[model samples]
Target chain A: MALDKSLVSGSMTMLILKLISERDMYGYEMIDTLRQRSNHSFELKAGTLYPILHGLEEKGMVRSYDKEFAGKTRKYYSITSSGMAQLEERTKEWKEYSDAVRGVLALEVSVL
Target chain B: MMEEYIRILLEQIRCKKSHKYIESEIRSHIEDQIEENMSRGMDPETAERMAVNSMGDPVMTGTELDMIHRPQMNIKLIVMIAAISIIGVLIHSLMLHDSFLQPETEMISGHYLRDVIIGLCVMTGICFVDYSVIARFSKLIGGAIIALKILLIVKSLIEVNSAVKWIGYGGIWMSWLLFDMIYIPIFGAIVYKNSRQGRKGLIKSFMWMYIPVFLELLSANMTCALIMLISMTAQMYLAIRKGWFGESYKAAITALVSGDVATPSIAASVVKAFGSVFPTNTFNLYRDIVAGFIANDERNYITGMLRTINKAALLFGDSSSELSNSMPAADNQYMLTYINCHYGIMVGIAVCLLIGWSLFYMFRSLIKQNNQLGLIVGTGCLMIFILNLALNILINLGAFPIMECWIPFISAGGSCIVLSYALTGILLSIYRYKNVYPSDVDVKMPKLKLLLEQ
Candidate 1:
């Protein structure tokens, strides 16, 4: 099932930070990688990706630089050390919330 | 089609500086999408349409980007500068009132007030200017200032006294050379924005740094030359340490050390210049003159008078002994001493603290700047303020030899007042645009070959 837009929107920064934590990426590449990794589940829009990336940059959570690829300029974003700490905190919170949701859903399935 | 989309999208954003990078980034993304679609067997036109559509609403994206990229203003900095300028005006009026000459109090105060007003206006105007434009034309601006100084030096040689620092017409005079110190910040921008990479860039920046120093030395203005040398060298060292020129630290240090070793020859040349300006006996006379000033000799007595006044200065009220009205240049060079004598030491200390607090605030803001050019230019301005204030204060306390250095906004001179405001204006401009520019924004200048051909 495709992820809900609202759900994805709320966690977009954490997701983007997680992606860049593994490796630096340009905007188009991040969108592509994210889609492939989610098995086409999380298809982030370009408009959505850029604003989050820029916001992350302003917060010092990510840093950006320009490099040339295929004779065209591309801006790449990399997660900073502060971003790593944030990702760790967010990941722990997400795990707890997901585990609780799964526990409640399993109980309902058995009752049904 | 992509251009139209970008144009519409950019129209929604208020910041002009962010437009360049945003346009390029968005255009590149769309191009990548078009390529992907073509790889999947769609035609180019249909792919372009789909890519544009998938990017979502232009206005929403633009507005979101704008929210992150708006300019910022440091209101506290503005208030501090205003306060300092007002303090300058009041102190100058006080000095004129206490003057033994009693020269046209109204006329002189009016002139000082006018200068302060003009300075404040200039500061406000410069605050609105985009400082990146300076980076774009750093070379041209740096060269022009140097040329103008050289022209003035030539003019000074042709005139009497051979040390005419001012240029005047119709009874209006301006100390043109005093404004040359603005070049230090411009030099920072040049080194940061214009120089090429590696050893060649390092050498080029050094050459640029010394040209003004050389000119000042030639003109026999030792104080200006010394200040320029120290500030520009500090800037160059900063650039090197930041790896802005992409040179190894060891190599850069070696060059810097060699440069320092060469300074004694420069000092010798300065001494030689002074020797030519004064007779051999005058050297003995100069030593005796300095000795006299120290030993309270009647012929050179201002330092001794200042020392005595300082000893009797009260913490919060006027000193027991009245401020000497016969003190020359009391309104400009010795402003701090005048304040200590008339207003009490505590008031003088408060003024120093105010100036110090402003510098500290500015330094903190500059350190937080992500933009390298802003940091460099701002540092140059900060160095000037610190150096001038330190020298002026030291001279006032009789700890150092009295020179013509004017405390930034506290001194009572037209050019000094305007120059301080202009430097502060640049700092304000840098702070104002801190958020608008990305750290890696490219400031393009015309090619040297094209310029040469023209």
Candidate 2:
């Protein structure tokens, strides 16, 4: 099922940080990687990805540079040390959040 | 067609100065999207449309992009400047206290305070505007300021050696020196903006820089002119070192060796015109005083001022106040003396430290920016402030001959207050956008020497 953008928006930065931490990726590459890794549950457009990446850069959470690839110069964003720390914290929070929701649902099913 | 769509998106991005880099990145993203769709058996046209549609609302995206690249302000610098301005006002108030009960003194005091308010308002307004926009229209601004200086020079000639730098309107002196000093930043911008245009551009930039200096000298404000010249030359040096002039030396030599009648004739005419504009008698008079070729009477005036300043510096009490009370124009030419007399040597030291602190911040901000316009304008502002403080101190110490320049913010001139604050505002404006460019380009980092073993 396709997730509503608003539902996925809160964790977008965490997802981006986690993706880039594994390897440096351009905007289009990150979008493709996120879609495949989430089993096509999450898909990001250029508009969504570029602003987040640029914001990350402004905060020094991520850094970007132009590189020649596949006969075209593309801007690639790499996770910085700050970005890794941010991702770790966000990941822990998200796990706790999902577990709480699952626990609530499981309790409701048991009551039924 | 895809390019046009991308252009439309970028046009809405407010921070258009950095559009090229953003455009390339966005263009690559769209191309990749189109390729992905086409590989799935979609036609190129359908894929292109799909890719464009998927990026979301252009306006929203543009706004977000603009926010990401917007200029960030330095608040700490602003607070420091405001605090210094308040200190300046308090010092001026204290110096004027004896005459404060007089209506005329009270009126003058009111206007000085008002000018500071108005000047700060102007400064705050300038901070919001992009400095690149200001640099873009510097030619017109510089020309208008130069014209005003010319008019003032003519007026000063009519007044006949009054040494008055301003015209009185409603009892307030509107300082021409302050207006002329502003041309330094505009001249800096012109030099830096045209830095890449080769030898001809360099000559044109220098000509623009020379106009205000020439005008300042004609008005008999030697100290102000020197301050501006030093600032302009420093900016020019930075531009040249940055390779903005782009192989200018080779072009200059080639033109000189070849019959290049244009370059040689132009140079000769410029020198001739400048020589004619500088009056010989006035030049000799000022030159003599500066070189200590002064007559006995002039030497006496110097000695008298020196004796008063020395006594004030040493006595540090009622004796200093008594000496200052006896001196003519004690507050005007004897700035350090008055401060030293009333507040003691420690206060004077604190004032010096304040001036040094401001200069330190200006240079620190200059190093933190990579933009050529910001660099040049920052350097111009830095030198103007530093030189004005230096010249005033040197004159007060009897090292340099007395010339009509204010003690920056602390001195009692309405125009001086307005202009000094206005200049500081510009410095703050430049500092606010210090990081607009990328890190390497904006900052001048030292090279780390690497060791090599054979």
Candidate 3:
């Protein structure tokens, strides 16, 4: 099932940090990777992606710079150490919450 | 197509500091998106459209960007201006009660207080107005002021025996002095429009200034007229040196004096230009007025008055009461003399401090402005305050001819107070939008650059 935007939006910074931690990427690359990694289930619009990137940059959680890549100048964002730490904490919290939801769902299904 | 979209998006964004980086980033993002779509076998046009559409909405994105980048008010500048204005008004009220100058014709303090309130509201209103809007409609504004000034001059002419003063309906004296200052933004606009064309543009700007100078000369207010001429030239010099002529002022002057630059027929061309714009009868009248002003020997009258005022001031040591008793009524033209004599040297020093502080704040703000028009307008306002302060001081010290001029905010004229406040408001607006251009702008100030290095 597709995730609601409200659920996805709250984790935008975490998702962006997670993507950047793997490799330095620009806005379009990050959006594409997030969709492919989620099997086309999670799609962050350009409008949504850029603001989150900018917010992360502003908060010092990520840093961005312009560099030539593939014969074209692109602004690539990279995760900082702080961004990595936050990503780790967020990943752990997300795993516990999803596990709790799945346990409740399993109980309901067995009862049926 | 992507570039065009980005252009429109940026046009909606107000903050100039972030504009360049944002532009590059947006362009890079759009290209990457389009390329990704192209890899999926989409046509170039379709891929471009899809990339742009996926950006959500340009307006929404621009609004989001604008929130992060807005102009900031200089609080210190505002506080400094407020302090000076309050001090000016208090000193004005003190002048009214001193009772040494003359028996009061009307309660001027009440009128001044009312104008102060009105002026404050007007100032606030102008502060919110974008100065670009003022620049856009400058021609209409210039024309309207010219018409108003001409009408006032004519009205003053018809009311003989009260020949010098332009008295309004209730015998309240109208200040044609400050009215001329409204031309400053127009001067900035004209220079901005024509700064790059050639010597021809410079002459055209000078001709526009000459219109007011000629009119004020006819109205017999020579000091204000002279001040306008000097200030306009200063503004033009600043704009031109900033590279309007594509050369330095020294280079341009050298070219002119060496006969390398062709001289335009200033008088004939100006007259011809005026003829084309105005009807025949009005043109003839303007021609006669110009001819009469040109023919009159202003030097003799000015020197005569200067000698008389200087001799009297030197002998008496206090010209307000002593000079007025012996000679013709000194009137408010001798503001510095009146202040120094009636109030003591300390009060005079305080008044000077107030004026000096206000100018200092404005000068600092002027230096920080990034927009070209903001720089020009701020410079023009600085010239006005500087010239007024300097001239008032010289006239007070009997160092120069006594002429009718006001002490900026402290002067007890309604129109002067209101218009001076309004001018300050415009300066504040310039200060507010001062950084509406990128900090990386290469403004040419060769002399200043040299001084700073030393």
Candidate 4:
């Protein structure tokens, strides 16, 4: 099933920081990596990704530089130490949230 | 198809500085998507359409980016500047009212008010101007000012003792010496924005810095030359710290140390080269004149009088000894000492604190700037304020040699007052646009080559 639009939007910053934490990636690469990793279950819009990346950069959570790949100039984003800390925090919070939601749903199924 | 989409997106973003980078990044993303789609056996037209479709809602993205990059106003800085300008006017009025210091000529009474008014207006006007213009044309602007100074120097040589420093027309005069303070900010722009990358760029920036310093020395304005050297060197040190020239820290430090060590010899050589062309050894002549005054302290009228008044000054009220009517440039250069004698030592300290506080406030804000151009230009402005205030206060306290320095904002001199305001305005302009520019946005104006570089 496709993810809820609002759900993806709310956690977009964490997702972007998480991707960049693995390695420095350009804008298009991040979108493609996320889509394949999710087995095409998540497809991020380029328009959505860039604004969040730029915002994270402004907040010093990430830094960016331009690099040439295959003779094409691409603007690449990389996570800073602060971004790593943020990703860790957000990952912990997400795990707790999903676990609680699954627990409640299981309880409802048993009751029914 | 992608071009139209990108254009529409950029239209929604108000900050022109972010446009070029955003457009390129978005265009590349769409192109990458199109390549992937075509590899899946889709037709070129369909692949292009599909790629553009995936990047949702350009207006929304642009608006969100706009909100992040909008121009910011620094209200506290504006208020502080206004307070300082008001304090200047009030102090000048107080000086005018004092019977001992009141000038015999009518010209002296009205001049301070006129200068302050004009200054404040010029400052307000400058605040609205985008300071990026300085960065954009850093070479042209820096070249033009240096060219003007060289022209003035040539004129001075031809005319023989017809004041090279003052440029006057129709009863209005400006001291090129006072105006040279603007070069500090212009120098910052050239180093940060125009200079090429790495060691060659470093050498070129130093050359740009010394030309003015050399010109000032040639004209025998040691104080102006010294101020330019110290401030520009400080700026270069800052650029090194920022790694603008891509040099290792050790290499940068060595270059700075050697530059500082070499300056005095360079200055001495310039003085020696021009000594015969001029009537006297201008450098040593100034030194000897000042040394003679110090040796014969009782005969050195201004310093002797200031020393006596300072000794007699009370902590919170007027001193018993009156400041003599014959105090030279009493309204401008000696305004600080006059305040101590006429008002109180405490009041003079309060004025000093006001000026010091403004400097501290400005420095605090300046360091926080994310944009390189803003930081460089702002540092230049702050350097001028710090140097002028330190020299003026030291002279007032009889700790430094008395020269033609004026306390920024508070002194009653037309050129000094206006120049101080203009510098403050530039700082405010930098602060005003702080958020509007991203850290990596290229500010260099295109298609213009530096005349010197060619």
- List residue ranges in candidate 1 displaced over 4 A: A18-24, A36-39, A59-63, A78-112, B39-42, B99-110, B156-159, B168-170, B260-264, B270-305, B323-329, B440-454
Ordering by DockQ: 1, 4, 2, 3
Better of 1 and 3 by DockQ: 1
Compose the digit string of candidate 4's lDDT tens values, residues B248-287.
8788779777876676567667666775565434666555
Shift of residue B112 alpha carbon in model 3, Å: 2.7
TM-score of candidate 2 versus the correct structure, residues matched by position:
0.66
Over B1-454, each residue of candidate 2 has an lDDT whose tens digit, in order, gives 6776787788787766567667777888888889999999999999999989878777677778888766667777777777778887787676567541345445555466777787788778877776667776777788788776777655555555444356567866676666667778878777765765787777787678666666565544666666776677677767766666675655544533332334334434543445334434345445445555243556447645664656557434433555665544544456665667666666766876887787787788676454557778878877877887877776666666666666666665567677777777787777665434442121212234521321
If you assessed candidate 1 against the hidden native complex, which CAPRI class would it receive? medium
Better of 1 and 4 by DockQ: 1
What is candidate 3's lDDT per residue for A1-96, written digit by digit as tens?
588889888887778888899899988888889989999888777877766776565445776655578898777787877779889999999899
Which candidate has the highest lDDT of all?
4
Which of 2 and 3 is the better model by lDDT? 2
Model 3 misplaced regions, further than 4 Å? A1-112, B1-68, B99-101, B104-110, B148-173, B196-200, B247-331, B436-454
What value does the lDDT take at residue B139 in candidate 3? 61
Superposed by TM-score, candidate 4 places the C-alpha of residue B34 at a distance from the truth, in angstroms, of 3.0
The fraction of reference A/B contacts recovered in model 4 reads 0.57
Error of 2 at B323 (Å): 1.8
- Show pairs that collide, candidate 4: none
- Report lDDT (CA) for all predictions: 0.78, 0.69, 0.67, 0.79
